[model samples]
Target: MGGSDSRCLRCGSTKSREVRIFDDPQSLSEAVAASNMPKEIADELEKRISSYNLRLQKPHSAESHSSQHVAAMMDATGDDGQLTLSSLSRSLERMDIHGTTAEKLIGQAEFEGRLIREGQDTWSWLQQSS
Candidate 1:
């Protein structure tokens, strides 16, 4: 597998990095026991039972994430602001939220109306539940 760098894959500007990796078997088991992670995750862990080197990827996903940046930006918008999904997706990418968690995050964020997608390279605001 290839590694992602610290720079934006699309733009050359420096990214505000936020994600981290944790893959220890014991820790993984503990986290699994604690959270409401979906069924596929539990099933995926079966592979780790046989393999010792299965590196765990991003822990928290976008759906589970609420941006301090967006929160602050939207503070003035109150209950009616808008945060686009693409920008939130980009923020999630910056936060290193990936894989299944990322999908869940997108789903949850949309469910909460925190983001709205308009067009390519376009987004207006991010609404945090008031």
Candidate 2:
């Protein structure tokens, strides 16, 4: 089975030559659905397929996620127009953003004039009312 023609004889050639049978039932079901093989892998494949299809149907974005981070931080800001590093850090945590990425985003925000550096460890959101 070293040649390019090598494939699972029982599984048939309906699936691409790159797919493989997985041990986990969920993964196996996904593979079976994408394969040219018969639909008799299991009854659970239907549920898995539906779940997969639902995930595929959701909206996906390639836009700036950092904007959300900035927005979250800005929302957490007080009425005095003060944004502390610790406060921003907490905001990032609430937004599920990692530390390094959050820091880079903060730097980017400052560089882009979205945020203004006030002190060594503090920042201020350049609030735009529009």
Candidate 3:
């Protein structure tokens, strides 16, 4: 059982060697569905992924601080009226939001039409028409 060719101790099966990067729940779910991992592990992972996706899809509540953070970011657009992903992450960090929480807030903002994607990692504030 070498480093690259390790085998599962319980079942004597060769472990998968492929490395996958999943940026979203759909991709993760797809990978889990296509994997040859044990049924128990794959089922657990699928359950957790479904729960995570549900959480992300839920609407932000009125008193939710996440909504406030998004509003603040929208109001703090740069001089060029643009917001970079890095900048948004940094701002969210300052507000004690990091990792997946920050990501969810950013996604929510975009989905709510508060931020319009302008490039791969840049967005512009979607100003409300009077």
TM-score of each model, in listed order: 0.25, 0.45, 0.43
Predictions ranked by lDDT, top down? 3, 2, 1
Off-target runs (Cα >4 Å) in candidate 1 are 1-80, 101-103, 110-130
In model 3, what are the clashing residue pairs, if there are any? none
lDDT of residue 29 for candidate 2: 79
Best by TM-score: 2
- Would you list the C-alpha lDDT of every candidate in the order shown? 0.51, 0.70, 0.72
Residue ranges of candidate 2 with Cα displaced over 4 Å: 1-60, 127-130
Q: Write one digit per residue (lDDT tens) for candidate 3, span 24-113.
A: 999899777667588898789889999998887666543576666766576446889887767767777666754445456658778988
Q: Model 2, residue 128: what's the lDDT?
A: 69
TM-score pick, better of 1 and 3? 3
**Arranged by TM-score, best first:** 2, 3, 1
The most accurate candidate by lDDT is 3
Which pairs in model 1 have colliding backbones?
62-105, 63-105, 82-125, 82-126, 83-115, 83-125, 83-126, 84-116
The residue pairs in collision within model 2 are 14-36, 15-36
Candidate 3 to native Cα RMSD, angstroms: 16.8
